[model samples]
Target: MEKISVFLDDYRKAPDGYVLAETMDECISLLYSFDIEHLSLDHDLLHKTRNGFMLVQLMIKEKLFAKRITIHSANSVGGKAMYNLLKQAQRDLILSDSTIVSLRPLPLHFFPANVMKHYLEVI
Candidate 1:
């Protein structure tokens, strides 16, 4: 089976070769349905029931994680919290040092448009 990449964001376009999930439920469903190789998450989904932070918590509790994960959230506080939680989960799970995981907060100017386009084109 070919593992896929997941991009979880409400208002951004997914990168090439990645599947997009606009809501926390959709993200969780995709995670359950696919063997995710890479996962990029975003916080603050306008008026959603759950956000990226919730997804990270679920992933940790269920012991479900991608081979590589990235947080591309613009919300600094939430993004940092998510990053911390994921790092803790990685430690608890004893993921290898080879695993590629990171928190990449985009600049304040990049949101819902330019940054998404740039990242989609580059990645």
Candidate 2:
């Protein structure tokens, strides 16, 4: 099976080989439909009802996640919240072994320098 990668953001463009999901609904739909290997998220979608944080919450509730998750948002509070929630969910999944997990690291070349630096500095 072909492993997919999803990028969720309203303004930023997805890197090559990634599917762009500009809204919560689109992200959810893609998650349900694909065998996603990696997911890059951004908060503050310019909409009150839908955003990256909501997507993380929904993923936790539904027990769905990509093998690797990256929070690329510049919003400190919302980014941290999403990261924490996803980390918790990932830990739970690992403890329970309820889903298949990938141990492989993501290819870092796809990430921009600023995004990587920001994420590294935050965590």
Candidate 3:
């Protein structure tokens, strides 16, 4: 299987070498279609309700997993929820033990889009 990196967010363009999915559905499609090497996600998507947490829930239910998952939402509460869900899934043995789950929140507002890129890279 071909390995790919996925960046899931609504307002920010993906970093270099990543395929961008602006919505949860698109991101889910990518997860099912590809061997995801790195999957970075934001909690608040274009659709308020169909956010990254829902996608994470579906992933847990379907056993759809990436090698590495990062919660990159600026919304600390939402991002923490998603991150905790993944970790809980891992603890419950639903997600792979080897799958790396990380949280690298980015402020996705009140700044140029490039700021996200720098924020991701810098911290």
Candidate 1, 14-50: lDDT as tens digits: 7778899989889888888889888888988865648
Q: lDDT for each of the candidates? A: 0.79, 0.69, 0.87
My TM-score estimates for the predictions, one after another, are 0.80, 0.74, 0.88
Stretches of candidate 1 exceeding 4 Å from the true structure: 94-98, 107-123
lDDT of 3 by residue, 1-123 (tens): 888889999997788889999999999888889999889999998799999999999999999999888898998999999999999999999998889898988766554566545435422
What pairs collide in candidate 3?
Answer: none
Model 1 residue 16 lDDT score? 73
Error of 3 at 80 (Å): 0.2
Off by over 4 Å in 2: 94-123
**Across residues 1-123, which tens digit of lDDT does each residue of candidate 2 receive?**
567888788877776668898888999988888887777788878686688788878888886777667787767788888777766765865323333322212233365565444323211
**Worst ten in a row by lDDT for model 1:** 114-123
**Steric overlap count per candidate:** 0, 0, 0
